[model samples]
Target: MGKPAPRSFAPSPFRVYNPPMSDANPLTRRESEILDLLAEGLSNDEIAYQLGISPNTVKVHVRNIFEKMEVQSRTEATMEALRRGWIRVPGIEAPQVEASAEPLSWPPLESGWRSWQLLVLLAVFVGVSLFVFWPYRSISVKVAGAPAFTTDSGSAVGVVTPRQDAPRWSQRAAMPTARSRAGGAQIDGRLYVVGEIATGDTAALEMYDPNLDVWQRLPERPVAARGVGAAAVDGKLYAAGGCAGESAITNVDRYNPGAQMWSSVAPLPEARCGLALVALDGRLYALGGWDGGDVTDTLFIFNPEQDRWEEGRRLPEPRAFLGGVSFLGQIYALGGHDGVKQRSEVWVYDPADDAWTPAPSLPESRSGVAAAAEGVSIYAIGGGQGEQPPLHERFDTLTRTWSTIDSPRTGPWRHAVAVVIGPNLYVVGGWGGDYLANNEAYQASHLLFLPLGAQGLQ
Candidate 1:
């Protein structure tokens, strides 16, 4: 017993680490799953889609994983996991050294080379180098918000990078009737456009099928109005207040795609036009707009069950021609015009709290902008003054930050209607210069990672 008490407790220079069990691990089961996906370089939205959860939920898990591992970024967490032998990445093999009794050997070169032979070898090396670098020297990519690229020849030239995750825009079938300031809604994988300018045919309703890449005329609304607010709730499309001719009107209409018909619903309490409408938690929200004389901060909630419009909390400021959408479970109001000038303000309204809180502002003032939500990102496209490049920006709900994306149109694309169907964003006709018949389709940016497992092997 005395000899056992005198035993040494010194550390071992050569030690091995064994990963802990699930119960002893810092992360939970769900967190571990998220960490594995993060190692694959999947974005929050992509991870949420794969897990069949909301992006907000994915974000929460990511934050928890960071806290548990005491790591700041995904790369750090992944490296830490590798160091602890907690996870294994596919297709990464260690170099193998075969055991051998003989000494290492190298190929023997000629004792001496002639000057002509050396010159020939040098010329071959230069040829191979130029051949390898020719393509890269001839190609360049102009990233969004990057400085202008100019060659010494003073000519503009670029090459398209073969990147799957890069944001790109493509042309779609042009609208039959070119118009601006129209109301748009999407239902059952189809986009619906209603009410163009009052000067022309205001009650023009059309439906676009992304699968077919075609547009079909639908039954017109009962009231001929323009600058209306439209949304779809519970599979039914609701079109609200807009201008008929010279003034705003309180006309609410509901369209059923299954029946291909339109029916009148309870109109708004007051007349307004150029408003922003969105559906949240089974109800319709009509945000700020012009009420004939001036811009208003009105927030009207429409109850389909009761068929009534209830006044909710007003906005922080009065604005018209704004962009609004129901992201996560809250209502977001983007930039709009307030009587005299365009605004860069952004506000979020939580239904549970019944209050409006200001979020991050846009990069520049915009009006008549179109906003749509896909996964964890909100796209604000087509607005702002001047003949500058089209202002196409994306807002990350998880990070609460905004970033610019590429746009097809070089000039302004205001008063356009945008809808997200599948992975493509369909932007219908708008007033780019005169009435534009442009049907620009934009593919949202995805974060492409190094393919893992079998894909990596392929």
Candidate 2:
């Protein structure tokens, strides 16, 4: 038999006194404990571990502490805690200041030397101002452009030789066929887009020549697929693992810009579509893909030397249509549709230890984002819930902050990808309202705008 239920009782309600101009019962006992930990410089995760609580719970408590304390951040909360006598240092001393405290005073100096001292101080101030405010201009680099190409809801193609001082956009040559969900990469000196599945013809490999303002139809892809992922290694282009007909395919194909030929490499171990490919060092990493049934976080690593695929660590969440880029020899995966809704998680993979770390998350939730990483900054451009405004965000590895860039004339582009060469980025075809033939190039300082010199399109 089960134990009998206990009876509940009502107690008298008592008012908890608080300081003037403060909330009654300033903070709860748990919040006070959290504030004490904050004063000790404990992070949310660290506090969670010490208190044997979930990190999410710790986060909630910390947030509550800030509210009751009328503080913005941990530092502010610690300062307030000290003021309220909620926390104290063991050895160090802190002097409290009143709201209406007077400023410090200095004794008067002798009148004789005061004027001379004032003159000397004025001269020093002028010299310092001159040194700090010297006027000079930065030389802007020249970016050569041909005709511009744009997708639907975007501008028409033209030349975009923008001033390095300010961002500018120009149209470029459009694709012969308007399609979306194509995979693109930079190999040699040209941009290649594989599998235009929107036309129901998933066998095309299209090449764009930025210097010549032209589009050339290369040989068709070996497999009929769309939303395939492509990567470049040693000037060679690779396309693999995409949606074919009713399901994802496992075929991997390699294209030689020098030989103008296509060859089949080892296929992927699993079938996946809407996946992303990133090349680091000499190896390629395939991350988070969709396989009709549900999204997956499976990661695959391919070794060119061995010509085979090896499994790697899985993602923290199941997602697809996300963006992946290799930067500083590390792989970063960001923003995807987790089958239910859009995700903003940013997961980083370090090949050295083969472990994953959480960097800063994306500013907003999105999917079908195209990504490109050069040096320390990674760019996530286009892609949203459906078609909205053109959104571009840059993540700086050094500062770990995300900054928004000027939007493209094109409004709401999805199923597109970006490739870096030198300081320029070519964002190719995607579905906006219809199959888009638009291809636009972004030119900014220190951007990966490497030209396809000897590897120029034939």
Candidate 3:
């Protein structure tokens, strides 16, 4: 009868097909095979090749496997499979799917679909709640406070609270030597105090660690000096022009902390003290300072790679002891004395075009202030009227406006040095009338100043 219908190889209808059921009781037999292969770290192509199936078929199987396992990623799927005893190794035996003896059926499609819908709805609900309920958050900071200035009609010298939060001045740590009117530079995170007026003609190099709240003595300068301008390029700290003993110095010295040694490098174009040295755009810019006698308008840039100094655009208003900082790619020269008068003038120098532009002036005219750039704001702290004003001002670069911060705990004076470590600013070694070695750190709420939001909300 037509070759007996070609004797089909299909199993008899009475023969039973028994497939392994997972303890989690959801995945189908084929889906379990696909997941097991996935757990073996085989990609779709490799899985398809091993299974003798098309990559498209593997993809469809993978999607179905994910839905059945309720996992988004392969790692999650593998983890779930292992957790639920859905997989077993060659040597290891598979755990029993269920303690109950009844044969399990696949979970209802409607139930799985409903669970997925519930998850999506929950996610959407949480996201909407977060967006609607938590739009903006408020944070308080301790900043140097605004000074209370009492002007003397002709030439007013006012007492300013130097430390913002506290009424009484507190010392943080003492420097190895008493220093005043020093050059300070921060490299990496270490605060380096280069040259300052100490007991003797001091060349003492002191380093302050903010993390430890301690000071360590570094190798002394090659020549005992003060008023030396320091800047870091790459990893090397360059100490430039200052006075050695009582004489003005042009000699530039380089310090290697790793080696704990010092070496002399190329000298500055002019011997200067009270000048500003800052590293901007990979080059060190040395701004206005005193050249033994007169205040200099001389601006020079040093290239560490070439070990040379090139003339830069000079400050429009010549002044020594000016606070200079590089912010938003521009060098800002703030409050300083021009020999005859204390200046509130703020000037910005752009290296790209080599031009100087006047910025919004400081609220108070003071020189020898400690200027530090934190984010987009520059803080002019504890500067004197000419020598030191008991004044503190903060310049917001974004707003181009100046706001007076609360005064420091110490009296109004300058020659104090400030360096920003993390979110806190440390003011150290300032002079009020006589040279002071006291150190103070502002941390509490009283020292913080919060800026207004776009909507004028604090």
Best by lDDT: 1
User: How does each model score on lDDT?
Assistant: 0.71, 0.68, 0.65
The stretch of ten residues in a row with the least summed lDDT in candidate 1 is 146-155
- The digit string of per-residue lDDT tens for model 1 on 1-458 reads 11111112122111222345732567777887777755543445445645766656987898898888888776577667655655543333223446588866644446566678889977975566445422222112121221111000111111101112334777776665556678898999898888763124367788888888777878889987767899999998999988765577899999988898999999999998889999998999999988877889999999999999999999999998899988889999999988778899999999898899999999998788899987778989977654534688999877889998876765566778988876677888665544444577777634333345321110
* Count: clashes, candidate 3: 23
For candidate 2, what is the TM-score? 0.61
Worst 10 residues of 2 by lDDT: 134-143
lDDT of 2: 0.68
Task: For each candidate, give its TM-score against the true structure.
Answer: 0.61, 0.61, 0.59
Instruction: Tell me the RMSD of model 1 versus the true structure.
Output: 24.1
User: Candidate 3: TM-score?
Assistant: 0.59
**Per-residue alpha-carbon lDDT of candidate 3 for residues 338-415, written as tens digits (9 for 90 to 100):** 777678899999999899999998887777768887766788887765334477767777898887665655465676
Which portions of model 3 miss their true places by more than 4 Å? 1-171, 385-389, 443-458
Q: Deviation in angstroms for 19 in model 3?
A: 99
lDDT sort, best first:
1, 2, 3
List model 2 lDDT by residue over 1-458, tens digit each: 33222212122111122334442447777776666655443344335545656656976887777777777766566556655655543332335556656775544667355867889977975565334321110001111120011112122211111212226555677665555667888876688888643324377888888888787878877887766888888888899887765567788999988788889999989888878999999999999887756688999999988999999989989888889998877889988888788888999999998899998988888887899875567889877754456578888788899998875554667678688765567787765644556667776444233365432110
Off by over 4 Å in 2: 1-166, 446-458
